[model samples]
Structure formats: C-alpha cells, structure tokens
Target: MLSTIATTIPRRALCVRTLPISQTRYASHGTPHYNEPSGYLFGEKPLPQGQKRKREDWELLWYYGMFGSMALAAVGLYYKPDTRYAMAFIPQLLTALIIFNPASKLGH
Candidate 1:
C-alpha cells in the first residue's frame, strides 16, 4: 500500500524542499545572550606558558593526610596478630594506589 501511494506521487513532489540559508546569525529562543570565549579556565585566567600551577596548602595537607592515614592503617593491620588483617592490607594498599594515582596526573 505504501509503495503504491509513493508511486502515484511525482518524484519532484516526493522530494523535500531545502530551507533558505539564513544571512544573519542570531541566538534562538530561551538564551538571551550569546557567550564568547573569555580565555579563562574555570572563570580564572590560565597560567602563563611554561609556568606550573602550584598546589594550595590545603591540597598538600589533604594529600598528606590521606596517604598518612592509609600508611598508618597498613602498619596497624600488619602488626595485628591476625591473618585477615594481613590479607586485607594488600587490597587496601592496591585500592589506595589506584584511586590516588589520577590526582597526581590531573593537569596533563
């Protein structure tokens, strides 16, 4: 039935008409203003070339605290007279290493 109907219509009528090219570009409805790049990273300007971004004091403290706690936990677990603690330490260390690795390579 669809084939018969399609055959009755001329090929020109079946073809879709192309829309006229718009000469003036304008933002569509909903957005009131068009945004242009201000060359900023996260609202702040990016660092000059060849300059490394310094870590904040709190970031250093956080990194130290996380690793220090993990190390202390591993030492405690290792010294405890149980096979389970020994078994758990391996996975805990591996998990910490996996999770912590990405933070070191964040800017690259």
Candidate 2:
C-alpha cells in the first residue's frame, strides 16, 4: 500500500509542471521604453542673459599671499626662539576670513 501511494504522488507532480507565459508587444524593432524624453528630442534652457559669473582672482591672490607669509614666519620661528610660533597664525586667520566670506554669501 505504501509503494502504491508513493508511485501516485510522482504522476500528480509531473501533471502540475506546465504553465503559460504572459505576452507583451513592442513597436517595430522592439525599442526599450523610457519615461523621460531623450536629450536629442528636447531643448535645454539657455543660461540667464545678464548675470555674470564672479571672478576668483582676488581670492586666489589672498591664498598665495597668506601661504608665502606663513612660510616666512615658520623660517623665522626656527632661527629666533624669541619670535613666538603664535605669530604664524595671523596670515592663516586672514586667509580663513577671505575664503569664508564669499562662501557664506551662497547660503543666502
């Protein structure tokens, strides 16, 4: 009786294996679907006519100036112990101010 039951289960499992695939159609040559229009099909907005990009010449000058001053201060500190290492901080502080002022304007 156990042998008969095991033989019947395999036949039932084989009968359940067949199924159907759902069908979908595409345009000629089967191009993929996309939500956004392609760049070639769309026109990009031109930048505003009057507003100018700000120049960074002043900022660059400040950076290089402060760097040179700091290097000089470091050499001075090595040669003269009386000249405090703290003096080197002045140019670094000014450089921080110059760099941050323009950046702070962007937040507004």
Candidate 3:
C-alpha cells in the first residue's frame, strides 16, 4: 500500500489587510499618545507646563462635610410616607448636588 499528499495555501495569502498606518509610525515614537495613566488602580497627575490645579482650603472643608451628610441622609429617606411613593430618595438627591457643586467653587 502507498499514499501521497500535496499542499498549497495562497488565496491571496489569506487576506486581512486593514491598512493605513503610515504616519512614520508616529514620527518615530516621541509622544504620539501616552496621556499619563499608569497601571494599578488609575493614577495620573501630569500638570506642570504652566502649573494650575491646586484646590485647597481643607479640600473645600471636605466637600462641605460631604454635602452635609448627604443632606441629612436625604431627609431621612423622604420621611416615610410609604417611603415617599418608593422614590428611593433619588440617589441621595444626586449625591447632595454633586458634593455641593464643587464646594461652592471660588477660583479654579
């Protein structure tokens, strides 16, 4: 008994082109895109080309004491009238107006 086999693989070399990457490979890599956000739980600071962002004042009094304790816990969860029609206190009144609107912004 005997056997023989032949193989060929050339349907235009199994086409998958998707081309258009010719900006000199990002001008030889000097900072085409690395907008500073390193590994491990997101951390990026990057701001000293003209220096700005420095919000202090005890961090706006700790975000105005976390918007007055989430506006007294959304007024005790809408002071119970069958949980105020099951409104669920609208995410603590939208997180107490987004932590008191940037701590009542003053400068930055």
- TM-score of every model versus the real structure: 0.34, 0.24, 0.22
- Give per-residue lDDT, candidate 1, residue 57: 77
**Cand. 2 TM to true fold:** 0.24
In the range 2-107, model 2's lDDT, one tens digit per residue, is 9999999999999997766865555745565664664643354444899675656798899889999999999997887575677887777866777534335556
List candidate 1 stretches off by more than 4 Å: 1-46, 83-108
List model 3 lDDT by residue over 14-38, tens digit each. 5757567764453566764665656
- For model 3 the TM-score comes to 0.22
lDDT of 1 by residue, 10-108 (tens): 775759786779765666566656566677865667889999888777998899999999999999988978566587577678667785453366567
Model 1 local distance difference test score: 0.76
Instruction: Give the best candidate by lDDT.
Output: 1
What are the lDDT scores of the predictions, listed in order? 0.76, 0.73, 0.65
* Ranked candidates (lDDT, high to low): 1, 2, 3
Which of the two candidates, 1 or 2, achieves a greater lDDT against the reference? 1
